[model samples]
Target chain A: SAVISQKPSRDICQRGTSLTIQCQVDSQVTMMFWYRQQPGQSLTLIATANQGSEATYESGFVIDKFPISRPNLTFSTLTVSNMSPEDSSIYLCSVGDRGSDTQYFGPGTRLTVL
Target chain B: DQQVKQNSPSLSVQEGRISILNCDYTNSMFDYFLWYKKYPAEGPTFLISISSIKDKNEDGRFTVFLNKSAKHLSLHIVPSQPGDSAVYFCAATPGVGNEKLTFGTGTRLTIIP
Candidate 1:
């Protein structure tokens, strides 16, 4: 299992503001992913971040709304742009091992937009 | 469409009993399944996973049983403890090696001592 950490454990922001969540891993990883969990809902994959390439976003999620930056193998950032009430959710980052399929997640950033 | 579905929203289990959480998927392309446990304010923790080629996979007290024909899978936790009380989510991916995962609505398990 990999050790992952995310900045801003919890935050309350005004609507229309933006927040950037950072994820750092202890060791180098090949794949990192961003996910969102809304109230009383399941987790939805936002995007996959790999170092030195553009992030691959799932359908219904766009880079404009959620921009991701993977500068290195152990660090990534996800910025929630133009936040709204619907954007209030837990943002989590996960790192997949180099050869293993199991992914370990960081303590998520809980964002509440009012 | 919701590709993965967990029918039960909550479950109450006595301590030392078995906790069974079920999940179903409509897509047959899903060849890998994983289970995660989430606490109130933390990220979901990966528990166990099973591949389509296998029918059962066990690790310690947690075991995952998959029935590909029915497109259904279940996680069984024997001798449930207080630490086992959390929201359990079942996720699926078409392949392995950190592919995009589709998650199901989690089932909250409460263990009564």
Candidate 2:
């Protein structure tokens, strides 16, 4: 299991503002992903952050709206741009195990857009 | 459409009893299934997983049973304890390695002492 952490555990932002959440891992990992959990909904994949390359965004998620950065194997960041009330959700980052299909998630960042 | 589904939103069981959480998936491509436990204000922790090739996988008190024909899988916790109370999410992926996971709506399991 990977020890993952996210900064700004919870935040309340005004509509139209952008918020960037940072994720850090204890050890280097090959696969890092971003996910979102809306209120009363399941976790949805936002994108896969590739090291030193552009991320692979899932359908319904775009780069401009949710920009992701994976500068290295142990760190990544996800930014929600031009936020709206609908953007209020828990943002999580997960690290995929190289040896298995398991993914370990980070303590999520709870966002509230008002 | 949701590829994975957990019909029950919540379930309660008495301590020392068996707790079963069920999940169903529509996508036949999914070959790997996993169960994750999540608590409020925390990240989801991996509980157990079962590959399509295997019908059952067990880890101590946690057991996962898979029925490929029905596209259904369930997690059974024996002798449920209060600490077992949490939201359980079932996730599936088409294959291995870096594949995106499709998660089902979680089932909130409450173990009454």
Candidate 3:
């Protein structure tokens, strides 16, 4: 079990603006992932943040809309570009520990784009 | 395509009774399954997991049953307690190193004391 934390626990932003959520882990991890949970919906994988490289987006998501940065093994960030009301959801960061198949999640950032 | 599905939206059980949560997956490629419990304003906590090779796995009062032939799995909590009340989510992964996971719509479990 890894201790994960995300900045901007909850926020409200105007449409067209972008909000960047930062994720930090207590220890180094090989893989970090970002997920989105819309209201009354299941969790959807947004992207896989790889250190020193570009992020891998899912089929329905794109890098332009959700750009990610992983500068080190213990830190990463996800920026919701050109936000809209539809983009309002809970964004979570997760880290996979060694020898464990489970991924530990952060408290999650609640973003509301008005 | 929803690879993982939780048909039930909610479930209620009396304290000290058994609570069962069901999940189904359309993808046969998935070999790893996990259950997570979540409370409001908090992140999900890992409960238990089962591998493809095993049909059942147990941890204390929680047991996970996997039926590969039916592409179905279930989590059973025996002697349920009030603290067990939370939203339970089922997730599946294709393999050990696979970073992608398909999650089912969570089922809110309520335990009545």
Candidate 1: residue pairs that collide: none
Question: What does the interface RMSD come to for each candidate?
Answer: 1.1, 1.3, 1.8
Candidate 2 per-residue C-alpha lDDT over A1-114 given as tens digits, one digit per residue, 9 for 90 to 100: 789999989999999999999999999999999999999999999999999999999999999999999999999999999999999999999998665779999999999999
What DockQ was computed for model 3? 0.63
Kindly indicate the candidate among 2 and 3 with the higher DockQ.
Answer: 2
Candidate 2: Cα lDDT at B4:
99
* Per-residue lDDT of candidate 2, residues B1-113 (tens digit): 99999999999999999999999999999999999999999999999998999999999999999999999999999989999999999999988766899999999999999
Candidate 3, lDDT over the whole model: 0.94
Q: Which stretches of candidate 2 lie over 4 Å from their true place?
A: none
What would the TM-score be for candidate 1 when compared with the true structure? Answer: 0.98
- In model 2, what are the clashing residue pairs, if there are any? none
> What proportion of true contacts does candidate 1 retain?
0.75
DockQ for all candidate structures vs. native: 0.79, 0.77, 0.63
How would the docking of model 1 be graded? medium
Candidate 3, position A53, lDDT? 100
- Estimate, for each residue in B18-112, the C-alpha lDDT of model 1 and write its tens digit: 99999999998899999999999999999999999999999999999999999999999998999999999999998986888899999999999
In model 3, chain B matches the true chain B with a TM-score of 0.97
lDDT at A52 for candidate 3? Answer: 100
* Maximum-lDDT candidate: 2
TM-score of chain B of 1: 0.99
